[model samples]
Target: MADEPDPQLSVPVGMFEDIEDLKATNAALIAEVKALAAQVTALADGGGADPGEALGGDEAAAGGEPADEGEAEAEQYPPFILLLDSPAYDDELRALIEWVEGVLVPGYLAEPSADARWCHLWFEHPVAVARLHAAWLAWQELTDPASCGYTGPSVWHRDHLDPALRELRASTGPFAGCTKGEHQVGHRLPGLVPSAWTHGDD
Candidate 1:
């Protein structure tokens, strides 16, 4: 009995199996890390293939082709504020405000004048909100190197920024009654003609 292995010191078969499993898992993880490192090195050396394609495989590298129509539409357009729910809208509005205050006002907005007016409470005006949100979306897309490349900023300035400013700050635009120092009190949207459908007219 003394020559035989002591039962007290014997390892469980299940324990050995668990250790083997862990070792295999660790090996797989190490291999994945090595692969990721190689990809990073390739990108650093300016390899021809896109990094997204390398990680996602050939399906993702299909020359920017989306897997489905819905995905394609989503990729093309940013989420519009009007389409969002209350919480999402609030979050988006906050981001838009940050961009407006931090980048737009300081960098592009000129001193408020009678000809080029601005309202302190511009958010209160629905038209102003819609216009600003559109411009902000364009700015985000055009400024990103991954989205539009080097010429994007120039195109954004010429097409999006200038037009939005001209419309919003025009004498007859949404900020018409506002001034440099004060918001327009008792501000009201322009009255619209009653809908023909509401009156049962063709």
Candidate 2:
């Protein structure tokens, strides 16, 4: 009976309950810390957009295929469209198409063809070039005609039209069969203006 008298003081039920609660809280905190670490990793890797980021795990955002950087770059600038540069199609045209598509298209599709071989190829498919030209004109119309300045076309015509570009146009490569008459009438592109196309955020 004397020893039993000190039971409440020796081990208080409230203290035991507090100890159990502390253990649970510590376990929960550990789990939360782990989850935060995973999210940090996810964010470091281009946050799931371009996998080329240093952290990796760069999943394409919005569930689409990862974009090619070169294609993206070419799209930013207007590249010279090589219509008749298929050498099996025509040697000069092939070289022109190769130069434009291989080198220029790799950058921006800006500037019209500058070389005679390129011009010849373009002339061979005048209709197509005309259509492209019309599109270019329309784009020019979108902006101030004065502001439609292109260094590539202007400079290439003025300076780089020598053997380098010429060789490219005439080099018996793949796209030599292009003709001047193909694009005589020109095809109407679907969305020439922003209002002509539908954009969906969904």
Candidate 3:
């Protein structure tokens, strides 16, 4: 109406709007890529991803289960101590002992009795060491707040702790014939019959 609005200028105005829209889209895409990169970096560094930001709000809200499960899955756990070699195994065992004496024994173990035996030299017995190490590893995983959450300890007790204690403290368990103060000095593993291939017609 106002002098026909200058037809040539109209095209430029429309093009300008399109360019602005494209710029906004590009900025949003860049932000998303940056966020993804940050998450990857965190995971590589053994630092777990942030739950709220990792999956985005809409996806997280859509399904509550994935986010909750992802928290534990994202955590990195150490390898079994028995799998390690020489000094590493020795080093880990020392730390394991610290946890056993400081946290495990004091908090969980019962008084030594004829039916429920214990040994001060439990480490001397390979089977006892293996069992305790397994329990200790489970303890580390379940007790972590970032991994197992609130129900971890209860689960550990039911699935790991009780079973190990039953075997370790039983009258005929690894500490058999051993007492709290007096470790059974001559404890020996039961002998196994030789294989036919090795002792053939001897």
Candidate 4:
């Protein structure tokens, strides 16, 4: 060595070790970032769970499914449940079922037929949801204070409830051969040929 350089003056050996440690930390952080990005993309692309069906932050944070009230609250409420609507087997469709059982079934839908217990099993029918939604919408509007009490019920029955219930409770449709004794049976769907169960003397 023509001129001996001070060892301490040279880039310290400890610095090299620090750089290696930094590199590993950076690599790990980069990997974590990439993973987080991928998760974000998946959530965006798939249109994450239905808002009505999704659980609250607490359940999600704890990695648990909603139970009891959370599950009940999310079910068929907020209209977001429409996207995830399954039949009765799912049980997550509580709102629609509750409305049907509490309001439509009790107040409007005709009594269940002797052969077919449509009232008990209405949630099983896939088409029942759309019909329920229509009726529920009418109920919300007609029951609102702005609606004229005398005309609201009549309009709902004529414009929304009757037509929807006709298709829903039609004999040839899902709940076949079922009818409310007080109401007409064999009501035909739009495209289907009419049946001969007209209300007698009403």
Candidate 5:
């Protein structure tokens, strides 16, 4: 005979649903708490909007349809602020890399500036430069009192600078990807000796 369905083995669906709901509710509370902390910090530093406006408590809720539009349109955190404000996490970290590669790379660093120091040949080390520039930009933005982000000098170094530079400076990073095996590289510096053999010629 087929085994009867084990009634004791099946948990009530409501129990799982309740657990998930509690998890989500807790996460939201954590986010709100961090946001509140950032608001307090920004105000203490003398730059952000009123704490009442930042918190959006029940008493501070908007009055009309236009207010709904404003709420929908407003950025909860600006992109640069999102980089260093880690207690309130962002899922769009990959998007920061994409924007850096797509925009900041081509626009700013692809070609060395005319006034750039000879040691600052960014095109030869695009990945490292890109990461550094991105980290530097995050530092400038987050440390500003008006950024309304929970970032200090140490926090910027720890959060924004450390991880990116670590990845970018690794051997498998962009320069290596573009240089090893059969890859062709165009910009050797003036004093560098020529390679004995072309990468793919043999």
Candidate 6:
């Protein structure tokens, strides 16, 4: 006898209906998300009226200052106070401070102009000059091994053992990446050498 055909073989219509329903639901969810995103962006760009005012909160304040005493009290630390007070010589003063950090401390010497402006270019801005003085003291404290020995003073030894002059010369070796026309700002001297240097052993 021939093999009988099997019966009850059928595609699940309910599964396809459920899948179609899920796709519709997913598309509706995506559209709703897009609309919510647009509303958030509109709120951010100040397109609509103030919601905070309607809600009766601090965000409605017109001025950008702190809303409460606690918020005002939080802003005690200001890094740019000196710069704002004395903006004129800020750049030169910053350069001078950086030079002292990179050159003078490594050379085991203090800036000659502890009180005067002969060494530093900008003496006019008192704030900048004062910051330079503070930087010098900080540099001294940082480079001294004893001052910060408890805080792992490896950096102190590194700077002290290798003098800045020697460090400059060392940068020209095969392993060193220095090239012609690549002058480092820290080592440049503005004035002419003294005449006493012409004598062999003064």
Best by lDDT: 1
Query: Clash totals for all models, in order?
Result: 0, 39, 0, 0, 0, 0
Candidate 3 residue lDDT tens string, 1-202: 7767877766866798999988976776676666667778888898965746685743434333455566676665555665666787799889888988999889988888887778888877767877888999898889997989999999999999999999988888888868667777456554652353132455
TM-score of each: 0.58, 0.20, 0.55, 0.40, 0.30, 0.21
* Candidate order by decreasing TM-score: 1, 3, 4, 5, 6, 2
RMSD of each: 15.0, 19.8, 14.4, 18.1, 21.0, 18.8
lDDT of each: 0.77, 0.43, 0.76, 0.59, 0.53, 0.45
Model 1 clashing-pair count? 0
Which residue pairs clash in candidate 5? none
| Backbone steric clashes in candidate 6, count | 0
Residue 73 miss distance in model 3 (angstroms)? 10
Per-residue lDDT over 1-202 for candidate 4, one digit per residue giving the tens place of the 0 to 100 score: 9599877789978998999988976776666556555556667898665433343433433344545656686664444233433463255467667778787777765555543235456555545655776677667778776755768877887888877877765655556644443322333234532333222354
Candidate 2 residue-wise lDDT, 38-157, digit = tens: 667777864743324422222233223345654586576533433223443255444445545564445644333323223334434433343333344343334453644655455444
Residue 140 in candidate 4 has what lDDT?
Answer: 77
Model 4 ranges off by over 4 Å: 1-81, 85-92, 114-119, 147-150, 177-202
Clashing pairs in 3: none
The residue ranges of model 5 lying beyond 4 angstroms of the native Cα positions read: 1-61, 64-119, 123-130, 148-151, 177-202
Could you tell me how far off, in angstroms, the CA of residue 36 lies in candidate 1 after the best superposition? Answer: 40
Error of 5 at 56 (Å): 13
Q: Lowest summed-lDDT stretch of 10 residues in model 5? A: 112-121
Which runs of model 2 end up more than 4 angstroms from their true locations?
A: 1-9, 48-202
